[model samples]
Target: MQTSSQLKRLGLFDARVPRYTSYPTAPHFKPGIGAELLPDWIRAIPENEAVSLYVHIPFCRRLCWFCACRTQGTATAEPVAAYLDSLKQELATIKGLLAPGIKIEHLHWGGGTPTLLQPDMITDLTHSILNAVPLADAAQFSVEIDPSEIDEARLDALAAAGMNRASIGVQDFDPMIQEVIGRPQSYEITKQAVDGLRARGINSLNMDILYGLPHQNTARIIDSVEKLISLGPDRVALFGYAHVPWVARRQTLIPTEALPSAEERLGLYYTARDLFLAAGYDEIGIDHFALPSDGLAKAHKAGTMKRNFQGYTEDVSKVMIGVGASSIARYPQGYAQNEPATSKYQAAARDGRLAGAKGHVFTDEDIARGRVIEELLCYFRVDFSKLADELSRPIEYFFTMVDGLELAMPGTTDLSGTVLSIRPEARPVARMIARHFDDYEMNESGHSQAV
Candidate 1:
């Protein structure tokens, strides 16, 4: 690994960069690419193609202070039921635009807590989704489950609906850290949820844990990672906590003084990373780890892993349709996002109109640069010869883009012939290195720490 002084000189300690889940991140999406253009994007998909679908449930029983996702707290089921109706309506509207024989290869239900849905709601939503577009053979359906909010009935409903994968959020096992983050979930409850899922034969489990939190230390993270490993997750996402109080107002509740410095944050990540490696987990991308038998590890080995809004994925579908308030969809043409406000999204959906509110249309340059960025992030290297051939461009086209990359971060990169690789020691600054190819100007405050 690069020494602290060398890394600091390269701006690893004080740089803010995008996770690059998308080519031009969400902030770059603008208005005017809304409801009117969304239908065309949907209709353009070829008949009989398999695609991915993402459903957003933006309601939570209690909002965690560390989350920046668009969500609201609701004490009653009335709002949730109404939102369910909107989702069904939106799905039906999309069905009208889809060509014949289209099937969903991947279906993911994400935050605020998809498990918040009652048993009947879960079944109803699943049925509605299938009615619109059936699941493809061997389709993978996953849901983000909150341990504090799940039970047997919900699990039974999910299993009955063909959910084969489950992702649980275990931010940290330490009680003090949980309290400071306002997400009070106990390890016992988490284990119970995991056990229930395994009991129902949903063994493909994914767990997410945060590294940088208020008052987090190497010892605390070590304990948390050990407890997480005890649960036997198939995959784990070790994310660095992004504290953007200016954007996520609830983050203001956290004590800024208690947060770790950039250097300490890096140490926390490496500590957890070493533990996962010691436990026989193969590192996936920059922040994920998976057991040898897991699909992610297989994808990594086979060079088929991809990064999307949900982070690293093995799904290779060219189209991903997002349904619900604040959801974003990716099409071959570009990206489209739904109305962020629930009220507005619900009104549009009920009226049988697409709820798209903002997005970006991909330019030729956008697609080329996007591929370079994605390849570098996923493999820590870019195969210029292959990209040039795939993109129908000359090799010199890519060579020009790397003109100053190595000079900017000396001794961290190697450009030999047609490939550019980031040195293993400099992988910690991979995001910053990838930024060398980003053509869009950024608002530093909009991103998280580079480390």
Candidate 2:
């Protein structure tokens, strides 16, 4: 394996760009598309097709300094209780828009820490969701948990409420790194959390890890990985630390000088990727990995893996409905984000509103480019010919776009037949390739590192 410095010397990691979690990333979302458009989009969903849902819980017991999510730190239950009330109301509002008796294929809870919600509150929310939108027989209900916030009772309650998957946030187990990030969790506590969840019949598990933190280095990260992998999570999401102190104020607490260099970050990523693969895990997308038997790995093998607001998934729905504050709902037409502030969200729901804040409506061309980007990002190859065939167009028409990318990446871009692929060596430039399809205006206001 090449060292970080060696890769840097070769200029492998240079650019800063969006992760393409969404083609027109969240920053591009303006307040243009709102409540008036939602009903029409919701009504357009095919009655027979099942969709996925993501619920955002924005509260955390302790705010990790390196965290960038839209979350609040709370020491009491009053705010959470109020938030739950708004969430239930939001669910009801969404239910009213969907066709009667809609079937859901997957439900996920993500947050500062979903476990911050009291056990009873978790049950209440789950019941409200099931009551409104009927779940498919094989629907997968999952949640992101903070090991520190959960007890066996809470675990049991979650299982009873139909949660089959649990993702524990274990960014790094190194004591020094944990202290710097302000999210300290012992290996024992995380193991117990997983054991408790499994004991309650919730078997699917994902452990999230982070690299390129303020004090993180190859040795420290490997130590964390070794500890986490021993606990045997079925999946792992290895994310590079996005140091954006400009946006998230708390990030300033991290000593920028201590942060790893760009080249070092690349090495950290490759090192982690090599470690996971050596452990018998198959890389799913850019950052996710799963054991061969895991649904994500199987999805990749079957060429059915999907990328969405929640990162890579097996949920192949064209639409994703987000509930709760800071949630985002994706329709074929566009994406809409709910208000991020808890009080604002609650107030809107209480006023009998959708809490729709700002979002972008995709043009027909935007949708076409989005599909091309999605196919290339998730599968690493896009059959422009096949896509052109679907649109009843000729491949020659898209040759101009290919010419543009070839100019940007030179030898890195390859075209054989009607299929386009980014060379394996240019995998880190995947976002650059995807950007060819992004018709949205590009600016500093809307993106993270391309790597």
Candidate 3:
């Protein structure tokens, strides 16, 4: 009760903050960092080094009301087929710019449903990507598989193309909640997908479940979590439902009154969290859990874990190239996002130009602050002395930014000898604490609840 009081007093329930997936966050990304700079950025990649690739398939059979991702619903294969061609063109353009010997260490296909692709389309897309930059030995190829859209033929194609890791989104298994959220994937369908993946020797799996959904209660979340546990995913991402109907207009279809209160939302998170821990899953940063043998767990234990647009990751590659519309690539120089509109992105790629539309070039201060934020979020602590050495700045360089953090968060953080740490009990407020280090202005309405 005292801890709950402290959390309430600290405004954890009321505050809305950026997820801090990126330091400046996407909303603050400005224009003018588009196509012109892409060639130079791609050329700067050193030969013989491994980089990550992210392919976005923005087409879905149906749009879920809770999602705010850049996606469109297409019932026909015509638009998808057309989009695939443009994606291939974009890959070819990237291939033209690459230096020899560059290899992909981590390849992820995220979506509106990468599984929406036909079996042949999957093989062809995989071939195009591999042809551009071959996968390095031991490279990890992961795809976001939609249970409702995938089947044996597609699984065979993915297996043949070397997809070793599969990520599935199981928001909740409850029928009522599924109906309310417009994502009608059932536990039976989800299990079928998992069974299919395992039968194909693709045992490495990542699953996502959500808390704070409309009509979610402790009993409801417990039931969903147990069902997810029965599926035995290698890694699980328990995310809080980010209800921003203003941003994701489709979310308006969900009744606002059905949503859990901020305090109830936090309770739901802890309820589900305790279940994962009790099941022998090692906590991986904020919302992720991994079996001890999973790469993510190893990364967390070894202190090499990183946070990106995809949330917690073990990939340490310095360069991550994103293909397809609305995809963002991270180069050492800065972050570049492709044209978000599929038509615009396709036109640019077909015309033999990169589709980069908006980005943020990292200033020195941006780098320092971004590292601080990343460290805080990933490890729940920032060692200023270590960062100073790594960044080649004096220890005092971070003092000004961190000054008064304790007061702002009020007993949630401990600053000792230039190192700042969020107490274990205060981890729920980590995003709010990270907000203090943000140099840019934030519109609270643009973010989700702090809890």
Please report the candidate that would top lDDT against the real structure. Answer: 1
- Tens digits of per-residue lDDT for model 3, 1-451: 2366677666565425678888688877778786868789999999998999999999999999989888999999999999999999999999999999999999999998999999999999999999999999999999999999999999999999999999999999999999999999999999999999999999999999999899999999999999999999999999888887778899999998999887788899999999999999998777899999999999998999999988999999999999999999999988899999999999998999999999989899999989999999899999999999999998888987776565566677888887889889889878788887887843353322232
TM-score of each: 0.96, 0.93, 0.96
lDDT-superior candidate, 1 or 2: 1
Question: Candidate 3 clash total?
Answer: 0
Residues 1-451, candidate 2, lDDT per residue (tens digit)?
4344544543344424567778678888888586768768888887777988888989989999989888888999998998889888988887887886578899999997899877899889889988778789989999998888998778878888989998888888988878887888999998889889877888899989988877778898888888888988899998878887787898888888988888778878888888999999998767899999899999999988878888888988888888888899998889988888888889989987898888889876666677788888887888988878876666776665565565445555678888888777767667666776566643353322221
Clashes of 2: 0
Worst 10 residues of 2 by lDDT: 442-451
Model 1 worst lDDT window (10 residues): 442-451
Q: By the TM-score metric, which is better: model 2 or model 3?
A: 3
Candidate 1 collision pairs:
none
Q: Residue 121 of candidate 2: its Cα lDDT?
A: 92
Alpha carbon lDDT of residue 55, candidate 2?
A: 89
